[model samples]
Target: MSSSALDVQIKSLPNQPGVYQYFDSEEKILYVGKAKNIKKRVSSYFTKQHDYGKTKVLVKKIASIKHIVVNTETDALLLENNLIKKYQPRYNVLLKDDKSYPWICIKKERFPRVFSTRRVFKDGSEYFGPYTSMKTVKTLLELIKGLYQLRTCNYHLSEQKINSRKYKVCLEYHLGNCKGACEGLETEASYHKNIESIRDILKGNFKSSLQQFKTQMKNFAESMQFEDAQRIKEKIEVLENYQAKSTVVNPKISNVDVFSIVSDESYGYINFLQLAYGSIIRSHTLEIKKKLDETEEELLTLGVTEIRQRFNSQSKEVYLPIPLDLGENLKITIPKLGDKKHILDLSKRNAMYYRMDRLKQIKITDPDRHANRIMAQMKADLRLTEEPRHIECFDNSNIQGTNPVAACVVFKNGKPSKRDYRHFNIKTVEGPDDFASMEEVVYRRYKRLLDEEQNLPQLIIIDGGKGQLSSALKSLEVLNLRGKIAIIGIAKRLEELFYPDDPIPLYLDKKSETLKIIQQLRNEAHRFGIEHHRNRRSKGALQTELENIPGIGEQTIVELMKQFKSVKRISKATKTELTEVIGNSRAQKIINYYNKE
Candidate 1:
């Protein structure tokens, strides 16, 4: 379709809450999204300039537009989720259908048997969860078993089978683990009562169960049944201990969903925490690859909808680090302090840890992907127009104005290229003038690279404040390479980064990866420069001292150094030892020089 035809379809969209789908020229769905006003949202795509390349591409490929108008935003969100799942649009966040998660199933029978399963059926049975891990499912099952006497076998306990004596009690019954519902030893009413308590326990409501157990223990003690009372006491303790371990905040905060997000340039990680009676019962972190550089709010909204639907959660309230409009049916609370803030922080930490672990795994398994992510992150963090794949950092080292020198360190793909490291002695500058030394080295390094037709670094770093950065920039200007390469300076006092022609410095977070890499480069350059300076100083000191000696030529000093290693060692050497290494006359001259000192 032409631009006119596309504009006509966008103009015809209604002004209401709905979902919209974008289709490419080949009639394939490219994206699915929801909006409060369909016309305004659709038109903004055409009017605004998008920074992300993918969003621009998506806009250009829009051959057609389709939409479904809804009465409210909640309906729109639901419809959008369904449409995305149905079509699996390329530009939408990927929401996995977690069919592999474990669930606790209560079978639809006369006496229900509870067990964990990976599959769900539409047989009218109750399934409690689709937990994130098998360990959590197992722990829940064990807790229920320790507190209640429930059947674990698959035997059908129909009235006809029980009346005909078709089944016998299993070993579980003799072990005091089951109530023998198969053999009719446990009444149906009593068994259903235990089932009700188990259901409540699974819902993370332990109050009723604890009350009932305390009452039973009190009755057993009154009847002088010491063993039964002791068993009941043990069960109570077990339940209490489990609850204490699970609860993270005040028990008054119940049946709410907590969500927090951590994002980078390419993906967003959202962590969901399902709380019941102030205990965290469910946790899941979703990784969403960004197709259009989506913001945290957009990803969080979509993530909450998808996660809640997948887990079959009917939570009326939610806690978030940021406030969002998720329809009027759900109450969204942004926690500022107290227990709510603590839980939100916990969720945020979970998201951060998940992101860290995922990046570490990707670094080992797919290094290219990891490098791309770091480059993109650095580009954004430094506000560069392009990724700094090749970078060079320059540092000047001079102690008390004595052997002034500069070092250049190269980094390719955010790692040090040790083979590309170079050192320079400041020949044009007189004293420890850092600015002059920096200007001289920067000019020489790039002049040589340009002369030899070698590849130039995308970025240049100066290990000083604004003064050194300006000095480096002047070289770029003289070489007619100004504005062709990015240059910045790092101050050693506070790790502040100075950009060319910018007075205000960029202060990255102390723990940010970009800052760490910049610091690494600065430190490496400083160390390299200091090492070269120390070597030059020591060599210069040795030459000046020995060259001043009378009748001590270069060859004689070389012969003595070959044997004694240093001037101090040669001076300390015995006459016989010196004669063996060098000639006797030169050896005596070296000994006389040191003896006068």
Candidate 2:
């Protein structure tokens, strides 16, 4: 919008609490937000410099202002939530769905019927949930039916109708599935009693149901009805088994809503725990894809609204690990001690697990996104000026100060680039002088790269302590390439990372992807270096055995060794086979040397 027109719109906005929406030039909603003063809150977007990149993008997209003034802040919060859920504005948390989860309904009738329904009718029926999944609803309903003989029929078994003999028994009664309240075979009193027990179970209170089952079992035992007693005993066991499965937390933590959130740059995972009479009645983790870099408070606030609305939660008390800005009608407790704290921590763990699973899914389904996130994270964690899209790690290896060698392993986008890996036979470094060996290899690697004008790695890692790093740095300095590329060294013992001038080492989180990638690079370089060293040592051993052969000069030995590959192969070669490569005289002499053994 033009500055004058925007100013006029802002001036007309009320100072009262309300929900404000930002629209783009195409009249598409960009964001939805609640505010005590619509003008001030909406104006802040254009007036202030937003530090978040997403917020800056949102501001640029917003071309018009729209708002609804409400009577109070609570109303504003509700309206903002509704608007976000409806339009799913670009900058708002938008995971909530209008389709409510399946709820197990026990319809209020002369003989109540239990079934799962997505649509709830307010006709005095008792509704158990808005469960997170249909599978949960099915499992719960199956457990309920297994414990109680409630009719699955939809027939309205009014008392007048039952007396009039208008309804007849169906296959359900013959199959022993239902008690047949429709046929008056089941007493209304007994049916109502079972309904009461179901109500207790739905409220997560199992004591009453278990006690009733025990009483029936005891009465049946006394009446010599062993089969009936066994049935009642089984019902007791089923009820207890279901209770044990559903009740994860303390029973005293009742009637509270628990929420926790874990987030990354792209998404937030918010887990909600519903507790009733000390057992967790329902638990769900919602994945919120962030359009902007929204704060945890904003995400949590949005989550609380969406979840409670979706599940029809009337919980007044909530437990959280961090403080939220939700207004005063609801009691939000930031738990710090005791069981509440433990439950809050559990919720946080659930959110973290969900986030982890989400990352895994992204890694499998969209590898490029996974690589990008890893690169960004590594750049931030290692404090590198640029993302290390091309990374190289160097390691030196030797056996008894003989056949010294160094290997450079390259990684592009956090994976090993085997084709780019190069092995260096240590030259100008006598014996096992690791520092000098490191300097020679690094100097040759980059000097050749510069000569060939090949792409250099953004970051270089030395797979040793400060000594190896400093040696590598000397080579960079001689080539006038010091500080041109980021360099660090990893010490094996403590996994300490050393920078050129820094005295203290940097320790990365052990589980971090950055640390894992560095470890992978280090291990690859070591493996490559060791393989080359071992081959060199083996060849040196083979050369020693061949060198002792009389009249076989080094040139003739080289030809035989090159053709045969190993001493055993040369020993296995026939005289004519050797002659074809090294001529008749040397071939006859090689045949004599191996045959003399």
For residue 461, give model 2's deviation from the true position in Å.
1.9
lDDT string for model 1 (1-597, tens) is 899999899999999999999999999999999999999999999999997899999998899999999999989888888888888899888777767889999888789888999899999999988889889899989988988899988887899999899999989999999988888899999988888998888888999999999999999999999999999999999999999999999988999999999999989999999999989989999998887889999999898888888888999999999888999989999999999999999999999999999999999999989889999999999999999999999999999999999999999998899999999999999988999999999999999999999999999989999999999988999999999999999999998999987889999999999999999999999899999999999879878988899998888877877887888887789878888877688778877878888
In order, candidate lDDTs are 0.91, 0.87
lDDT of 2 by residue, 1-597 (tens): 786787788889888889998899899888889987888888788789887678999887877898898888767877888888889787886676757678888888888888889898889998889887788777778878888887877787888898899999888788777987876888989988889988888888888889888998999999999999999898888888888887776777778999999876567889999998777888899888777677888888888877887888888898977887676788989988888888889899999888788789989999898888889788878988888999999999987878899999999998898999999998798899999999999999999999999998999999999899999999999988999999999999999999999999999989888999999999999999999989888777866898888888878877877888778898899988998998899888888988888
| Candidate 2 lDDT score at position 559 | 85
Error of 1 at 588 (Å): 8.2
- In candidate 2 the C-alpha lDDT for residue 228 amounts to 95
